[model samples]
Target chain A: MDDARRGAIEDFLRAASGDPALRITGAALLSGGAIQQNWALDVVLHGAPEAWVLRTDNAATLAVSLPRAAEYALLRAARAADVTVPEPLFLCKDPAIAGAPFFVMRRVAGIAAGHRVVKSATLGGGRDALARALGQELARIHSIKPPRADLGFLGAAPADAGLAFITAQRAALDRQSRPRPALEWGLRHMERTAPSPVPTRLTHNDFRTGNIMVDEAGITAVLDWEFAGWGDPAADLGWLCARCWRFGNVAQEAGGIGPREALYAGYGDVDDARVRWWELGAHIRWATIAIDQAERHISGVETSLELALTGHMVPELELQVLRMVETAHA
Target chain B: MHEPPDAANLLETARALLLAELLPALPEAQKMNARMIANAIAIAARAARDNSTFPTPPEADLIRAGAYDPGTPGHDAAVAMLMDIARARCAVSSPRALDD
Candidate 1:
């Protein structure tokens, strides 16, 4: 952490926690998410303070996450409507408070198994049920209506969001020194017959199995609201069931365990044309993110084995993009 | 029914992925992906052994799921195009598919 940023965060934490004597004792990075940094922060309060999680925008960040303030509002909105989410305790947008924007939220505890949840014995017999539950939760999220102010902040819709995504990605990848035949082909496919125009909605751009917290009962909360925005809701569904997000079980396409039936069944009417369009859009989106990630790795943006692996998924996802496009037209 | 892949053929495919695909990119950090690709290939080989008759990977999913119209004249052509990429990168091979 930058020392100045650290001090600002310290001051913000002291004031936000309502404990002047509270000071950060320990901080360690958590696993699972990379875009928004989750620092397991331990604070000793003067009176009484619980273990709190600090989510901040790292200097090195991905484009997908919602801006900190936006995410805070999103969490507040979801929480009010009975959607389980990390309680948005305080949002600090003042750069004076944190190096960059950050938020303090009630830490939720549970396993969000990216790789094992698909066929886990813990989820025994509950596979279909859990899938249905996830769908319902997503439905609730999609049902939300943001105020004109929030919608304005979220920005205007791209005429062809999918094509816009493809063009942006092409521009970024064209600068790279690599063989990107698969990406090129996928982009062409997306461009040839783009997703049809559809009504955009409040979408959790990263809603998927891996991003959800599940326990014995079922999905507890959806994490990673950074990607939340106003877009095609089908993009969310397609992203959830996308080939890459399924982790180990590609066979279980419905967010790894359930079929699209349960998900769409809950999503209701699913707006097939829109969903198919967004499905194609989501592929382009993921592939673009992947290529950018790969570029990051190759450029030494964030040097980690994991980052390199993320970069490699670009080709695989491009293939999926083609599949989604073909799936749309087929 | 799935056709059983010959053990030797599976091994050969594994070798090719390891050597042609993974080995060349043996930069220190690339091992994770190299291994993942290797593992995915192994699992795919196991699946292949059980059923050598690979379903068209992106087949029926597109048509049935509204990915495209099966009745479209060029649908088969599209499938063939997708298969070419799959055969090259995904290491899927068929004996009797003379056209592909």
Candidate 2:
């Protein structure tokens, strides 16, 4: 913690909750999220010695629309309505807080790893129950109505979010990026048969199995709201079921836990046409991210083994889009 | 108590080719795919072998940290352990992906 940032934390704490003597006791780095860094902060002092988590963007190479303060506000708002989330304390926009901006949320313990709970027969319930719960939670999140002013921040509803996403990806690719035939095909197909009408709502953009914390009993908390924005709720649902998010049970579409029906049931409606369109769109969105990931290797990032494999998923997703498009035509 | 179908065998074979045949032909720079392909093969093999088996303590031991890393592949045993664990978890692959 730098001098200016530490002082900012103190100031924000005092202003938010009217406490001045809060002291930072301990802190340790936690891992897993690719785009950001989270620190397990053990804060203790006068008043309530609250435990907190400090999150900051990890030296980003790509630009994004959401900001830390925005994430903090989203977390705060979500927590108030009983959405399972890390209780946010304060957000620091000051760049001096260990480089990029950071936000503090009260820490809670539960496994956020998909592999951990899904494999544990005791925890996983041997059924698709958890995936159903995730669907329900997502529906609850989409239930919230953000202000009209906030809609612009989100850009647009779910219908064409996929198109906007494809445009962004194609622009990135056209800039001397690596040529991926699979991505091209998926984009063209999506363009040819873009879903009709738009369904917009607040979306937890990265709501996959790994992002949520689960215990033996049920879901403990939802983490990582950085990608949270106003968009199609079903887009997030399809993202939850995207093959890229499925670590093992490729056949089990609901975050690799169960089928789409179970997920749909959890969402409180099985026949919502909006979700199906987003489902195909989600596949295209994932393919775009995957193709760009492959290009990142060419773009000279860390070039990890998994990143390259992730890049290869574009063709697979393109095939999925093609299949869905053909199925739609049929 | 049952083995995965021939599909996993095919996946295992494809994964092997990705690592053994395709990976070796590439330069050090392109070796980023070596560990993932290797881990994918390892997991597919385990998943194929135990697709029908109930969740056992021994089967829960196959996550490979090395496969998760970019530069250094963790020990093969860890990878095997993760692969084994993935057999039970429908998330039988890398739960988290490395940046592409």
Candidate 3:
């Protein structure tokens, strides 16, 4: 950040916090958000040191992700529902303050990397506790249903979540340059075996290991509300258990952290069939996303080796989708 | 007609060199990028060696039309054929995925 922007943010914080004496001791960019920018801020508040994270839009935004202001409101709603999330402090809509609209929130400490989180047995107080805690957190998020005035931007809850997902995935696939036959088969299978309609609930659409923060005690916060919206509550369950998110720990079906029963034990009373149906959809969802990420590089919109390799991940995901459909038939 | 060290051979040798020498010398942050490059090179090498051109049929249309729905006349046959194609692609793209 430049000095001018830094000064503008400092002034905004001073007024927002009602602490004229507050001063920013340090500011550094936090890594790992390719589509967004998160800056770690160290400030002395009330004569004590405090750490906060400032989230802002990147140069470009994905079509489906929520804006900064909506994300701030989501954090507040999740907090109100007792879902573990960083406390949203303030939102600055003025682009002049930071070159884009931004929001600040309390920073929670933990490892959010998928590989490290799945490998470390010490983190999240062992696998069972972590998985169960995640299930409980998801249930709390689902408790925030639609018809909410604050979450009006999410539009109406889909009458049939299964069909809605299939339609969305098909549309995304159509936009791609290549025809994914395996993905098409998977979608067709999902369409034929669509699950019965369930109540619409707020879903943390990207709820998985890499998106959640885990400490030794347990989950500290669930991060990444960009893809969140009202959909099948079990979609979160399926997303958590998706084979791709297992990070090679395929034995542990629940986020590569613990058994499915343990996670269900935390959430209380979930239909296994519904979860399996959504799990199938999750594979298709991830495969489509991987292709899109790769397209960002292939189309020269933004080039990165990581994005290029992500394109390669589709075959594996496709294989899984085929296998899963086979097993479902059996 | 091609040279002795063909495109696939050159890619394989370059990948081996990257792992054996350049990878160790790279900084921690750049090492991940190096690994990704090596992975991409391996995939490219495999693709270069595989000459089979598997043209994908308009199965999406058929599938969407419910032509291959379960219990239909060609349902099982269509699925088995699709699985074969999926395996063939994985063989060149990610053979590890076909392990199970």
Candidate 4:
């Protein structure tokens, strides 16, 4: 950040914190969020050091992501529900502070890298325990239901989550420049077998492994509430079990952490059938998202090798979707 | 006729050199990028050798138009066509993802 921006942020922190003597010791941009930028801020208040993460939007962001203020509210709600999340400290709406709306939250330490977390034998209680903990964490998130005035931005919970998602996917497909036949087939299959509405609950729509922060003990916090909304609880379960999210640890299907039984055990009791159905939904969702990410690269909106390669992942995702559908039919 | 070291063979040689020489010398951060470059080169070499355009078959168009919803005639054929398309894509992108 520039000197002026840092001074503005320090001023905001002083006012928000109600500590006139607060000073920013250091500020550095942290990497990894393609949609949002995270700045690691070191502050000293009355000689006590503190670490905070300032989250703000980049020039271009995913259309589905919630605004930073909305995301702050989500973090607050998630924290209130005893979901492991960084404690949201304050919100900065005035763009003068950082040239964009942002929020500050207490930084939590953990390894959130997908490949490393999945492969590590030492971290997160060696898979089974971590899986169970994740399951329990998801259940707590689902405990927060819709019609919550605070989460009004999420609108009303869809009467049928499956159909609602399929509609959204189809609309996304329509926006694409070219027809994706494999994705279209998957959507059609999903539409044909759309499930009845389960009880609507607050769903962390992106509750896969990569979105979680894991320490040696277990999950320290569930990160990225930008895609959260009211939807079928099973969608989270399916997303966790999706093959694409498994990071090559295909046998340990529960986010490549542990088996489905362990995950279910953590959730207390869940209908396995519904979760399986949403697993199919997860594959379709991922395929569409992969295409969208690729389009961002291809259209010159954003140019990154990662996004370009993500487009290449569609074939595998398509194959998974087809295999799952065939298995369901059989 | 082209030289003995054909395009595919030349790519293979370059990839071998990249992995053998440049990869070890790269920093930890650049290693992943180097590997991705190598993989891209391999895929490109494979595509060159295959020489097929990898077109989406006509049945996919029928499928996209909803001519093969479940229980409809040609649904199985449509599914077969889609599987073929997916398989072809995997052949270029990640052949190991395909079923045995």
Note the Cα lDDT for every prediction shown.
0.66, 0.64, 0.89, 0.86
Q: What is candidate 2's lDDT per residue for A29-119, written digit by digit as tens? A: 7863556778777766565567778888766534553677778877877776568887887777877645788888888877877766555
Give one digit per residue, the lDDT tens place, for model 1 in A169-238.
Answer: 6776566665454455455555665657565567788888778888777776689887777665677887
Worst 10 residues of 2 chain B by lDDT: B57-66
Q: Kindly list the interface RMSD, in angstroms, of each predicted candidate in the order they appear.
A: 10.3, 16.9, 1.5, 2.1
Specify the highest-TM-score model's number: 3
In candidate 3, stretches whose alpha carbon ends up further than 4 angstroms from where it belongs are B1-4
User: What level of docking quality does candidate 1 show?
Assistant: incorrect
**TM-score of every prediction relative to native:** 0.71, 0.69, 0.96, 0.94
Better of 1 and 3 by lDDT: 3
Per-candidate clash tally: 13, 16, 0, 0
lDDT of 3 by residue, A128-202 (tens): 888899889999999988899999989999999999999999999989877787888899999988988999999
C-alpha positional error of residue A84 in candidate 4 after TM-score superposition, expressed in Å:
0.4
The model with the greatest lDDT is: 3
Model 3 chain A weakest 10-residue run by lDDT: A57-66
Positional deviation of residue B1's Cα in model 4 after best superposition, in angstroms = 8.3
Q: Which parts of model 1 are misplaced by more than 4 Å? A: A1-8, A23-26, A44-46, A94-98, A158-196, A322-330, B1-86, B90-100
